[model samples]
Target: MVKSADGVIVSGVKDVDDFFEHERTFLLEYHNRVKDASAKSDRMTRSHKSAADDYNRIGSSLYALGTQDSTDICKFFLKVSELFDKTRKIEARVSADEDLKLSDLLKYYLRESQAAKVRLGCEELMMGILVCILKQCRAVWLGSQRLVDWGRRNEDLLYRRSRSLVDYENANKALDKARAKNKDVLQAETSQQLCCQKFEKISESAKQELIDFKTRRVAAFRKNLVELAELELKHAKTGFLCVAPAILELTQ
Candidate 1:
């Protein structure tokens, strides 16, 4: 039995026990991948935050430098240009780190796709087992119905004894037996119906879980993309600052 988010217990069918085990294994692997991705995301977030803070600090320092006299401004500009060059190299390293991260993210996405395929295969196997079981149950029910019909039709022959009292007794006994058999068949059919209902509910829950997993993966991807874009913008701004003094000198 597996417990769902709602605390409902989903009983696994014996026929699909192997499939369920395979699914459990896959889930374990998927969980590990999620943990790795989460760790990487956290590192990336911290790195980006540190880089942003450093850029802000440098910008504040540059603003203060701008308040000095012309000679001091020239000396500051020279130093600022050297600092900007160093910053440009740092930006390159950051870009490289982002590229590596993107690569890892893509690999993780591929793994997710493979995992989804495995999950789909498992579902298909479970569905096949369900269909086979339903078919077998239906066959049994149909066969039981035919037996009941045959017994009813042969009631007279079954009681074809010489004495009237004996014949009446035999007919009553046969009727009782037929009624018991019908009751058994009805109970079996009811059990099968219940089992089918449970199976369907479990299948739906699995589908919903898959959807939720994909939603989370997509959200993470979007977040990473946004961060990468922001990093690129920051790099471009730094480049502009590095070239601004040269532009101003040429203009003069």
Candidate 2:
């Protein structure tokens, strides 16, 4: 058993390029999922805001009806309107909290998964820096490309070496050509070796970076979700508390 650079004990890698390519693909897919989630969250935020506005409009209509006339029914309308008003405010508060804690969190990550060359909005900048899985995936991709180059060079060297060997065997005049091919093969070998070394170094760092990326992402999501849940609960309780007395009076 051989230990990988990420400190995971495993069997030897038969194909280093395949390993990193798989990782890069997974990260890209994961980023796409995050983008989808961010879009959904934005929709949810808009829905929440719309609901709050609807509550406010309903409350205003009820209030207008109550004030247009004087009767027990009108008083009841006023009381109901108060309940609706409280609901509107509470809903607005909940919407804001969700936007701040949940929707923004997803948006921030979505932006972070991008190349980071593009400038973010002032709001996203305030959220945090944009360096994580995507950045490391880029590194992994470069490393995989280097491995591909090395493989291509090695294949070229093999083909040339075979051709030169055949030519030298067929004609003594081809000796110089074979020597020239050998020199090219030696240079290609050196370049391929360098590529392999750089790829190995990148792969090692990428493995560790990916591990850290996962850890940080999980923690951040957990923290944001926990806070959002707490805020929602608080708003729910406050809304209930504000409407309870009006409900009791209406029932009586």
Candidate 3:
């Protein structure tokens, strides 16, 4: 039985077990992909910042040379240095925006996905003895025990009934005991039917829960990706606008 968040026990069905297995696989693949993405995003942010610093250093060197020389060429160098300074500012902004929108987003989701894996009760994901232990594993164990108990009781009842039948055939004096054994078998049958019904009900509920989980994660990923794209476009446009006038000035 799987323990729900509310502490209620739910039966484990084939579909629910399959769902957990599928989800576990998905999370593993997704975690690896996102880890790589987050690392790349970090590298990109650093590259942007490094480029900005280089631009600033070059602009400063040019400005110093222009000031020391004081010629027409120096004036031209001064103008170019000013353009470099402007470019440096734009690059800096780009770096900040990329870190905020892309790097941070990737990192947040990386952590979130890890948390999700834990919450899903993955067998391979354990923290301590009591912390984030595998709920699915527990469910499977309980389900197995339940099945074993039912089978044992069924076999015992059948064996008892068979023996009672043999005794009834062998002697007329064992009729009352045979009737008692038959009654016990009938009670066991009733219990087996109730157990089956309860199992079916829990299985249906668990299946729906698994379906909803899949849908919810998909929607969340879609929303985050859309937002990231929009922010990236905005940053690109702003960077372009910042550099256009500098390009025109240099051309003139």
List all candidate RMSDs to the true structure. 20.6, 14.1, 14.6
lDDT of 2 at 229: 91
lDDT for each residue of candidate 2 in 1-252, tens digit (9 for 90 to 100):
111221121112122345444554665676788889988887887888899999999999999999988998899889999898888888888878777777766765665454221111001112223322232246544643443343333323322322333333333333345566765555555555555455455445444544555676688789879988999889978987898887899999
Please, what's the RMSD in Å of model 1?
Answer: 20.6
Q: Please tell me which model should have the higher TM-score, number 1 or number 2.
A: 2
Give the TM-scores of the predictions, in the order they appear.
0.40, 0.62, 0.55
By summed lDDT, which 10 consecutive residues of candidate 1 come out lowest? 124-133
The TM-score leader among the candidates is 2
Q: Report the C-alpha lDDT of model 3 over 1-252, residue by residue, as the tens digit.
A: 122221111111122355556765787888889999999989998998999999999999999988988788898788889888887887787777677556655665575456544444322222211121122256634543443343333323322322333333333323345456765555555555555455455545544644654565466457656766786687678777867877797678
**What lDDT tens digits, residue by residue, belong to model 1 across residues 123-231?**
2111110011121246544643443343332222211111222223344455566567765555555555555555555555554555555566677579767877787
Q: Model 1: what TM-score?
A: 0.40
Candidate 1 overall lDDT versus native: 0.48
- Which regions of candidate 2 are displaced past 4 Å? 1-15, 114-180, 184-189
lDDT at 165, model 3: 31
Best by lDDT: 2
The TM-score of predicted model 3 comes to 0.55
Candidate number with the higher lDDT (1 or 3): 3
**Quality of model 3 by C-alpha lDDT:** 0.58
Model 3 residue 163 distance off true place after TM-score fit, in angstroms: 40
Give the whole-model CA lDDT for all candidates, comma-separated.
Answer: 0.48, 0.58, 0.58
